[model samples]
Target: MASRAPGEPDYQRLAFRYEPMAGRGERRPVIVVGAGPVGLAAAIDLARQGVPVLLIDDDDKLSQGSRAICFAKRTLEIFDRLGCGQRMVEKGVTWNRGKVFVRDEEVYAFDLLPEGGHRRPAFVNLQQYYVEGFLLDCALALPAIDIRWRHRLTGISQDENGVTIEVETPEGTQSLACDWLIAADGARSATRKALGLVSSGRTFRDRFLIADVRMEADFPAERWFWFDPPFHPNRSVLLHQQPDQVWRVDFQLGWEADPIEEQKPEKVMPRLRALLGEAAEFELEWVSVYTFSCLRLDRFRHGRVLFAGDSAHGVSPFGARGANSGIQDAENLAWKLGLVVKGLAPETLLDSYDAERVEAADENILASTRSTDFITPKSEASRDFRDAALDLARDCPFARRLVNSGRLSVPSTYRTSPLTTADRDAFAGPLEPGAPVPDAPIRIGGREGWFLDEVGGAFTLIVFAGQGALPDTDALRPDPLPLDRIVVTPPGQDGDPPLHARAVEDREGLLARRFDAAPGTVYLLRPDQHVCARWRSFDAAAVAAALQRAAGGEIGRC
Candidate 1:
């Protein structure tokens, strides 16, 4: 077990420099409130896209405890685009399999990453403080991002053109303005409250006690869930491994249990001892009792003000959806906001962020709610059903699928989004419109790299011209927004030179098999790496129309 250090964060306090905003009459392009993972990620994404960003946080340091510990593959991929994926993966605990138990007997287990070829694993378990610190370092390295510490948003006013905000600093009050404002201030968002927006959802009556402890246990890096175990009869408990030998233990307490009493050392120590035996030696790291609710706002966007992360929506920790979904929200909005700010897309493009993410929130909320219900059955009938499922899961292979400890987070597909270009040709595999671009190993410049690494943070046009002549793209250029082209050719196509600077040889044929690509097939991808459109053959006019639709120019066509 790792020893605890005093004042763990030890981050330096940044000086607040206030300029006369009224006299200069200057308005920044974008202002992001909160310095958490979501806000810092948005700032980095925007800055990487050549947009100046102002990131303000009320706290001078990173998050105190390991608030969010699960980082999904999609979220990690987004972090990769923001320039900190490798650092995070190296520091975090990676795991792919999870086991579920009924009493002392194991019922079912599942592997999240069943397939290979992806650069990232299914998920990484790292403390929130580490993620925030890494994102802050990445943001500071970007010259276009200005991070202000100890600057809190006090008041906000928005008009047709932009937003005006009053910030409270350590020195005094300062006024700042921006064309757009992102509220990542967390669940009890001051920005959301000031905007008079309300979140609507159900709060579960059951409470869970979370305990982080440093113990030199020999448990493998996997999620272990127990229902009605001897140590905690008729209740549920979960355990996960994290970095620095810190283990997170969650015990489900009934509605009648007092939250304050459950967090006390006297009450918590007994439970820990029961789970880890009397002879186990361990140091307590952190403890908290929380009642999770599945809630979200009616709208994520209002005029010039936008919301992301927990401020936009919140879910139970059972599914590990909260932070992962928030990071996805930042990734989804950053590119659209960049295009809008750069005048490459219409203001209506921002509306898709609300549409796509609201749907994603609902999906997450639904999954989390189901998992919560299964874990903590509210009624006798529910309890019977859950027990029956677990009992059947032990013997029947089909019933194993019915067991749900928590449906670990997966990226949502925006199939019905307005920006998705409906497929005109039949495809076999999962590379459909609104789906994230699947990763595959490929050879670029005689170097090995994943497909996603080549087509991120920018609009990409991938043409699968198998050992044939390439199409002329000179006549079909989308203005303002830069479009990068990658030609994927057959294995023995080095004799015929590539039309573009970037060309990848489909060495293993994984790209062709996964995408169901044929000769002359073309795929148009968005900056967020979602497939927007595809065609059996490249048509200049059709591609142009699809690009226009993708940029939120024409309605009803997508």
Candidate 2:
């Protein structure tokens, strides 16, 4: 493989081996379409779970521009599980503070990671190309994943048991079959179109021009959003620093503005010059005009075919919801698909993917819609309200709460998910069922590590055994899917080692505080690391029932 140039990606064409498929009619267990971040993430995750994945993409190159630059902490953790988080964090620019401006006056500023002691930062700004490259490398390194570039999904059809897809390769067209299909084919999804699926939602009239420029500057690594700035009169603008001396600038253009003309060098140069001033020398790397919509499919799961990422739902970029949510969708779906493929869980478990992710999509759409509405008010009354909020936010702290300059991406809690085993006992903290496991510093045999790192990517039963012996494995489920058990003891417990091999000491009492842990509290965590159930005391029958419920089985609650 050839190395990529400074700003250009090397488009390496991968070999297609459909001839062998023709000789032996074999249906792969999983087929992931599209090679973008979401598709790559799903493929990598499935491969990690010991599932063989066939990843197909229409293109052989990375994304052209710095698209979807903001990556949330949760997404980074998912990347960490996928084996590429360290590289992304090292190569991306980390920013937690964001300053909102009304004209030239700074009104309000906020910090995403207000508290300390986190493994990952609040967010990172890396170009979409870099993300895809890292994900592609991770996928290639995994033996279970076979990536076929230039393999376009031209047709798709599914029945009760499997899906048959037609691919258009450089050589010719070929047909392939799969027991499961994951459509991560992006916003203009060819697979979605072939399946005759259409997304329904509101498309905003507002437009935005994104310009990626390369320049040596001393701008702080922070998000700067201007509402009616003097540089660009009435429209809103956003600026952020990226890696490699590159910067992203977004200019809000009204509905009537011509996108083609706005993208021209003549039109873009003046705006860039006004923003950066005449003395600043900068080279334009990429420019594009875009209009976003908050749209989603009626259902993410259709029989044997499933949709993930932009193929299932899309939100405006203001909140960084686009790629971040897509990556999460991949993570959420991967574990369920893995369990189903292994026959450890019922097929009905897959239905929870749609039920939970649709709720998440609605949330992202709502947040993005509100941000768009605030940034570009459609009515005079709305503009008056927005201006009032901004004006008062300059002085009063209460008014700052009203300002919504894109509610930066955060993982959605699947509170109402069917997979969640409802909490029957009273709990004090936020480590509830369906919520992602909170990260905390823990001491394991004199070494420090994150709590999430120890309990993720498997069905884990975390026993807060404060000076108590760990629960015996014989008491738990006899033999289901592999369940990892970790015993977290209180600080300075000199008790004998527990039954489980993995044990940690909550030296700072962070886990105790975050989880409201008692001497015998137990938490049942899903493979994706979301809390499925918790109890004040360990009950083998309850834990077994919850595990069955988490895996889409009918059972009585304790």
Give the Cα error of residue 144 in candidate 1, in Å.
0.8
Q: Provide the global lDDT of candidate 2 against the true structure.
A: 0.87
The all-Cα superposition gives candidate 1 an RMSD in Å to the true structure of 2.5
lDDT of 1 by residue, 419-489 (tens): 88899988887668998988888888887778888897888888896645688865676877788888887
lDDT of 2 at 541: 90
Off by over 4 Å in 1: 3-25, 492-501, 556-558
Worst 10 residues of 1 by lDDT: 11-20
* Cand. 2 TM to true fold: 0.95
Q: Each candidate's lDDT (Cα)?
A: 0.87, 0.87
Name the regions of candidate 2 deviating beyond 4 angstroms. 1-24, 494-496, 555-558
Residue 129 CA error for candidate 2 (Å)?
1.0
